[model samples]
Target: MPTDATAASTEEAATRVVAFFETLAPADVAALGRLYAVDARFKDPFNEVQGVPAIERIFGHMFEALDQPRFVVTGRVVQGPQCFLTWEFLFAFRNFDKGVTQTVRGASHLVFDDQGLVTLHRDYWDAAEELYEKLPLVGGLMRWLKKRANS
Candidate 1:
């Protein structure tokens, strides 16, 4: 059971994280230290890394590869020192369909430290359905594979 103070802290931490992600930009990557612990761990379908520097590199690559990439937090649940956030990642491929925005629905599980800094961040999303299937040459193949798998 969590006390009122613990619940409030959790909610506050989650709120800050949501705000950070929703307004994230290339310049904001430098400030990740304020939200994540020095040795925080971050993992997604395509990346598994620890430490703030490694996490920063991942976000840096995201900005370099996409145009207008942003996260819209749709829902959140906080319990004690952990929180879960559902979001949609919106962006346009810099080299591909630059005129159209693509959305990737995903969720992130975050565990906060005593100081409200994120200690563990794990993202859940289907890359094939949300990302690869939206690409150019790979999109067709991925769609075909999905059809075959479902048949």
Candidate 2:
């Protein structure tokens, strides 16, 4: 059982995380230190990094590769120092999809430190389905593979 204070802290943490991602930008990379611990570790399908600088680099690459990328947190579950968030990441490939928004549905598992800064962040998503399948050449191959697997 969690006390009222604990529940409030968890809610606040979840809200803060969602707000941070909602407006995340290349310039906001520096703010990672505020939301994450100095030794925070972040892992996703495309990146595995430790520390704020490395995490910032991964987000920086997002801006460089995509246009108008944004994250919308659809759901959040928090218990104690851990939180899980279901989200849709919207973006457009700069060279490929151009202005068309592509949505990647994913979830993030986060562990926070005593100070309420995230200590570990892991993102879960299907790379082939959510990302590679959106590409012109790879999309066909991925679809074929998925169809074959389903049969």
Model number with the top lDDT: 1
Encode model 1's per-residue lDDT on 15-73: one tens digit a residue. 99999999998999999999999999999999999999999999999999889999999
Which sections of candidate 1 miss by over 4 Å?
Answer: none
Could you give candidate 2's per-residue lDDT for residues 87-145 as a string of tens digits? 99999888886899999999999988767889999999999999989999899999999
Residue 89 Cα positional deviation in candidate 2, in Å, after optimal superposition? 0.4
**TM-score against truth, every candidate:** 0.97, 0.95
Cα lDDT, all candidates = 0.95, 0.91
Top TM-score: which candidate number?
1
